[model samples]
Target: MLTSIEVAGTAQVPATDVGFLLYKHPDRVQQFATSQGGATVFFPAASPELCRVVLHVDGVGAKVDRAEGMGRYVNVVPFAASSRLVVVLGKVFGDALAGRCATRPELVDNRWPMTLTVPSVPTGGRCSPAELFEPLGWTVQTSAQPLEPPQWGDSEFVTISLSGVHTVRDALRHLSVCLPVLAGAKHYFVDDAEVDKLQRLGDGWLDTHPRRDDIAAGYVKHVRSLTDEAVMRLAGDVTTAQPADDANAVPERRASLARHRREWVVESLARAGARSVLDAGCGEGRLLAELVTALPGAQIAGVDVAPAMVDRARERLQRWRGTSVWQSSLMYTDPRCRGFDAVVLMEVIEHIEFDRLPTAMSSVFDEMAPRTVVITTPNHDHNEAYGLAGQWRHPDHRFEFTRADFAQWCASVAEEYRYRVTIDGVGEPVEGLGAPTQCAVFTRDDSSPQLNSSEGGRR
Candidate 1:
């Protein structure tokens, strides 16, 4: 059970300056008690290149256990980043939230590159993370967390990553208000005082936000009177509010899909005891990043046909000195691609022409055969969820496969290559249609045909 927020700093502002802004000593660990639980604040990493301060709410499990009724037995407060966590944050960082930095007053209004990571925040239906945070000036990235035992399917809770250039005060205030709204509930009763608090936290930005009404309503627990009053007050105080550019809010669901794909692949690889991995069509190396972190001490590498993608991958994996990314196509066999414990092709097969898929897939199953192979692609059957009943997800996608179609193809490949394949769905499962993304995990069968340098596929 965990709930935490990380504040990252850049070289321009330096990590030390963040200490002055927050009025907390970087080296000291501070603890505070809240109505929900105890919160501990400390720096996990502090340097010129990057600085991160983590505020973690602990003792939540014990507190939940002591609560009365069904709340004690069935509540997400212990694990989900709920309104309780936001309230604790406000209490713990009161001075910082008010934009008061006694030691460095000038830094109070300065904007700097900052990123905040909230590991688990419940985003109920009715509003997506992009709709809520984007209007308030933060770029949002979210990964939906699956339910425990997994059979329950994906939960409403998501790990939210927000990045933007803004004063530390603005960022703190944004989270102070938005995180709770995203959580979609308040732990306490809502009243006029709550409206005042919401107005104060959302002072400058809420008036201009496209989802301001939703935010106001959600913040005050959906009490009609309070929501109306809060919205009116927000409308009146518009002096400092800047118009948000709604045109550029990135569609975040695709990012979530990519994350789900990566997590599935990594888990499948780890389950198969894969110590080394190669990402066959590793685009910009998003999967590579996950592999390095998830499978530490294991050899990791990625290959893409595009030179630009390879360059980006190289830069992205620079932090991991041992990992590598190179330019190579999955349709072709390269000696460098063989002999890894696992190889992954994530959201890639769809981009290849249908006729060339066999060649590309053969290169993976026959030539660069690994102990495990994980493949993920968009399920055409789930396209209706995206309002694209008969359309491709991406313009460049040569073809998309329905669940049955994907399964049949995987079965053929597994039989042809002499491997065992298990198919599963990724992302939230749609009723009757299954998950938005389909996955096929292939394990090499030792008793079957051996790996060889086949000449049929491009090299």
Candidate 2:
């Protein structure tokens, strides 16, 4: 009975930063005790080009008891990669998986090309590795490991090798959620906390995943009630809608606010005479759908980091001509966003860390160099009016900005990128506090001359 997990990869990000991201120094090994036994995490190889972190679990002391009549029999629990290992992985690298790296904040939103290898994973079912990961854009290769006795046939465990381009957080989250699903069993009992665990780890990609139900079932130990609840919640249905006066407001109000934001974004773009648009960080194609209807003749394209979101966007906009959706990260340079008349970041910038905003904005203004850029974010000043001060509207938001803060940032970006910027309020204004949403429209100074080619123009 052996239990061990290895995450080896060459990341496009700095090697030293990888250690900080994982919250473990590469030069030393850290050990933590588990109920069954204990686990050790160490970086066997750390370099500028490659790094390998291994989690080795020793289950020598683990035992299960069985009772027959008055006599009790005890046997050692099988220690192939199981839910225990997943639990340990979460404990060891939880911060990295959650996209929190205080030491190297910029890398939090960065998508780094990586190669991940899990030496042994218990896949009780016959499902192929490709079936589980390929849809998420991972290139997977699996090899079965045989049982000790040839007559016993092959074991449930397999060595998995995966290569893909993903943010470090995305890669870790995928492993955290999928590993337990692949194992198909948990050594410990499952409870309500398990449901919360599944949802938290599966945040961005789970709802629209093809095997979502199966993953949910596996995570909750196939408890039908728990699985049903998780599935409904993931599909955005389980939670009750609060009334408008409630601190958080109702789902209807939230939807209305989103609709208002999208409308204002389209209005600004139209006002600028933008006929070809790029919707950066477009989640689920909501704004893209609005763009199609509001600007009928415009060429619209949307890009998001989550494949599920991109897939949903594609489905939603399939009937609209000159509309396209794909997976991309605004934190990195993307050529597809180039040559657009305008790029819209509707209620998306707040989700990115403050330190990473410069990189993302530069990628859009410096690299893509669109003629106009429209951005919107939650106005923190209005939070108090809603009785939600000191709290963010969304769990993923790194920071909500006040009207002044937003204006200052926009002014700085406009000047740095050689654009004239105007700040405006969106949604219904609240006296001196202004609207619940703040927007900035940045128009490039044609006479200033761009460092890059000016392919931007009204289509």
Candidate 3:
């Protein structure tokens, strides 16, 4: 099986710089491996008058295992416009999708007139092309293909053509999010990470999309819990309070509180005499950037599981000296993250699954074992203070911890690792409720023989 996509440039905005945008030269044929098989990306034509790019994906052959004897197995893996294509697109055109065009800086921010075509995309009888793209400002044309004669009725696949003016980044973002929804099933398993991917890639446009529910359902394969959470997040109803008389006041207050949280983290690190810091789960490097300004002499490094977030963080800290950003998960032990004097998990723990917390804690405490470790998570008890009772601050959060819950977890981990723990609050404190965010700081006990042996052995 094969699936492919073609993109053509318009006369006014010729696609001459398409190669630069994709970070692949027109003269080269790029091949990437996929779960099913391989994908090849090449430019069919390249010139000022016209430019075209094609992505061709091949499916792998199916083989039966000898262990399962005498049983018939069917390989129903989807190959057309599936998550495989999304993965290939990310590999071949990630720079373009991320809106990075160093060679053609002038075109980075401009919307180019172009035409996009996908020859064989499975719609799964969910929706029409017009219904999905028209509302997103694209002019759509679709043609359905028929299934095999006599054996089956109409096929679920369709050829779609979209013409519009859009930034390459926006166009690719739309395709990456919508293509899997159209396929109706993923090539890989769905998990909370899938929800985070959707939220991150669909950050700007998905919130207001007219077919958001349909899109969310299709993307997550209709897993009720995942779909509901995605939809709630995109709708901005997860933790937002009802409109009050002073709408501006609420937003202003929230911004101030966020600033306070970051400031507290930085001040605490400085007080601990931390000269080197690792910002674990540093999404977009917001706190990392602030740390750069606040502690000009301190060495800074950031790590994130998402490549896109790491890329953004790198861009944000490009000018800062002695600062590094890379893509890596905190769930496993990483040699590069082992020697920092301090590690900050600011506003990150709540997003991790409960089952995975132990691995993350072990990696930080037993493996890296920074002198000081700081973590902050949402205060569940404080939600009601903002008129959001029994609601989480973000949909991607696997579990939010109240003050007691957070403190208990921290104390247990500290005890297991020979460290002393202290807890504090961030943001405004309510009478009976607590602050919107809670912080836990863990310090290695200097008297511990394990700490002394580890340091002495290194010397």
Whichever of 2 and 3 has more lDDT, that candidate is 3
Model 3, global lDDT: 0.75
Candidate lDDT (C-alpha), each: 0.76, 0.74, 0.75
Q: Tens digit of lDDT per residue, candidate 1, span 242-299?
A: 3476655533212245566678788888898999999988888888998899988999
Residue 41 accuracy (lDDT) in model 2:
81
- Candidate 1 minimal-lDDT segment of 10 residues: 450-459
In candidate 2, residue 94 scores what lDDT? 81
**Which is better, 1 or 2, measured by lDDT?**
1
Model 2: lDDT equals 0.74
| lDDT (tens digit, per residue) of candidate 3 on 16-44 | 67677777777889887765467777877
lDDT by residue (229-287, candidate 2, tens digit) is: 78887888866667757786644312355666777788888899999999998888988
Off by over 4 Å in 3: 1-13, 61-78, 148-153, 239-459
- In model 3, what is the error at residue 126, expressed in angstroms? 2.8
